[model samples]
Target: MQYFIILTFFLYGLVFGSFFNVVGLRVPTKSLFNPKRSYCDTCERTLTWKELIPVWSFAVQKGRCRGCRQSISPLYPVMELTTGLLFAFTYYLTGFSPELMLGLLLISLIIPVTVSDIVYSRIPNRLLLFFSPFFILYRILYPLSPFYDSFIGAGFAFLLVLLIILLSKGGMGVGDLKYYTLFGFIFGFSHFLLLFFLSTLYGALAGGILMKMKKAGRKTKIPFGPYIGLAALTVFYFGEVIISWYLNLFL
Candidate 1:
């Protein structure tokens, strides 16, 4: 029965992932509802129902658009598969608890933001605004250990990021400031601090690798939103385990 429920979540996740792809790609451009149908970005041809079956369609089409025969971006299938796995894993971890709702919400927010950041090097304010109310409502309903930690965390993150922006002078953007502050509210102070560290660590590591491969120069701008999303997901899933492991090392 457990496995069956996990499978159901995975299937539903794949479908939602498909929608998320659309939302991520369109929201940044403000064309979300203009066309009203999924169209091939390369060819601008409307995709038929058979062409929209999540990961299956990508595999059947051999990663090429039938209309233009252009190779597809591969983001579609990857996001769908990732969402499915994440949904299943979240279910396995939290079962049917309220935490499961939080987990699902986190995944939904992270996936679309990651998609937008990867594609456009921009995180739409609209996307963040859309999810902010939900997160606020969740925190209100199930306040953290001191409750005020949420507000404190958010304020701390805002000030920290603001300091960074001031000192570095173009090192980060307003989008990042908002993103980090929102996550601070979601994860509270200690965990939000962890999220910040992990995100910077990830961004640094990725930048190093890209430079080593000569894929990017020092001046090349790499989007930081994906790293932030990854760190948020990590903190959501394993922050407690990680914090405990660290504390035990000192003891």
Candidate 2:
């Protein structure tokens, strides 16, 4: 029964991940609702329900569009599979609770933003706007949760980032600003700080590697949103363990 429940959530995540691929692709283009259907990006043929079976259909089609036989981007199946695994991991860590559900929801929300940012260096405002209400609801309903911490996190993130943006004369984009503040609200202040620290470390490490490889220059602008998302998700799961270790050093 436990395995069955976990499998169900995994499958459910894959289904939602498939839809998230569509949202991530379309929302950036500002065409979220007009077509109201999924289609091949290359061939433009509308995909049937049978052709839309998460990772399975891609494997069945051998990762090509049925209409045009053009190679499809592997991102679709990869995102589906990744979401499925992440959801299963969340279930393992959180078991069953409102926190479990919210953790899953946060994953779903961040995936699109991360993808969009990595691909285009632009996070869709619509995606963030859509999820913001749920953050508020999470605070109201789960009053015992770290609501105050998240509030302070959001405030600190926004003002500090805004100051940096001003000093840099637009070195930071609005999307980055909004994402940092919103994630602060979602994860609470301490976890947000932890995530921010980890994100900085990740960005620095990746940048150093790229520079060393000559794949990027000192001035190359790499997207930071994806790193932030990765750090946030990691901290969400292992935050208590990480925080305790850090505190023990001083205590």
**Candidate 2 Cα lDDT to native:** 0.85
What lDDT is reached at residue 10 by model 2?
93
Q: Compare the candidates by lDDT and give the number of the best one.
A: 1
lDDT of 2 by residue, 70-145 (tens): 9988888988998898888899778998879788878888888877887778889999999989877987788526
The CA lDDT at 72 in model 2 is: 86
Mind giving the per-residue lDDT tens digits that candidate 1 earns over 1-251?
98999999999999999988888888998778795688888888999999999999999999999899999878999999999999999999998998999999998998898899899988889989999999999999999999999999999999999999999888789989999999999999999999999999999999999999999999998999999999998999999999999999998
Clash statistics: count for each candidate = 0, 0
Candidate 1: C-alpha RMSD to true structure equals 1.1
Model 2 residue 105 CA deviation (Å) reads 1.6
Model 2 residue 187 CA deviation in Å: 2.7
Per-model CA lDDT versus the true structure: 0.93, 0.85
- List candidate 2 stretches off by more than 4 Å: 144-147, 169-171, 211-214
